[model samples]
Target: MHPSFQERIDEVGELLQRTKAARSGFYSRIDRRAPAKPVRYQVVGGSFGMYQIKDLTTGKTRAFRNDYKAAHDLAMQFEAKANRQITVAL
Candidate 1:
């Protein structure tokens, strides 16, 4: 698993516990409010393939498309896009 996946797992765990979002939505296993908070992630060209961005700040990571260039571009854009923004293609 990628490092970012671990980070997001931690972050989401905390988020789920705090909000009890896991019990919400059509599927109790899914969090209804999961999409509420803004997360930073990227999908850019990587050494082997596309990569995801691990938020060095929160120690949280998210998996994005496996593309190095795409990941790098989104990482750069996350610096400017609003929190409401989720996906952006570069």
Candidate 2:
């Protein structure tokens, strides 16, 4: 016995759906194995109106003289980059 044209098409569609589901599960397992740590930033005050943006994850620091806003902005940027998501349009 042979499948009709519509039945063949349906079989292909089911195969494609199964393949997609398996791929999704594979990636999900990979994601669970190595979870991402949230980036932490700290703004420290120094003498002579100096502000520092400290990245706790990497133990790196950036200094700003009399500019708290710039220091805070840099810290915020680092946090944003660490937490950003990649989106793909199909």
Candidate 3:
């Protein structure tokens, strides 16, 4: 990884942390009024952890193969993915 790319990734991580911190109750289950519900994926024999990536825009829902990983990578500023199909929202 080039130094410049690494720096960009670090910056993206910082932004994600800040956003998560701003919404502490998000990933937690303490609030019954949580806006989103998690979706599950049963892939043959794979243990797929569930997560969601809301458009926070059109309010449309799509499902991903491996959600959390997809979301994390998408959060990165240096992410090189041009097509969104690799990441489906649920």
**Best candidate, TM-score:** 2
Native-structure RMSD, model 1: 14.6
Q: All models: lDDT?
A: 0.61, 0.77, 0.49
Q: Is candidate 1 or candidate 2 better by TM-score?
A: 2
The lDDT leader among the candidates is 2
Residue 83 of model 1, lDDT score:
55
- Native-structure RMSD, model 3: 16.2
Better of 1 and 3 by lDDT: 1
- What lDDT would candidate 1 get against the real structure? 0.61
- The deviation in Å at residue 71 for candidate 2 is 1.3
Q: After superposition, how far is residue 67 of candidate 1 from its true place, in Å?
A: 1.1
Q: Write the per-residue lDDT of candidate 3 for residues 1-90, one digit (tens) a residue.
A: 999999999999999999867666664656645444322222221355654443333444333336666654543322223222475789
Q: List the residue pairs that clash in candidate 3.
A: 62-89, 62-90, 63-89
Of the candidates numbered 2 and 3, which has the greater lDDT value? 2
Write the candidate numbers in order of decreasing lDDT: 2, 1, 3
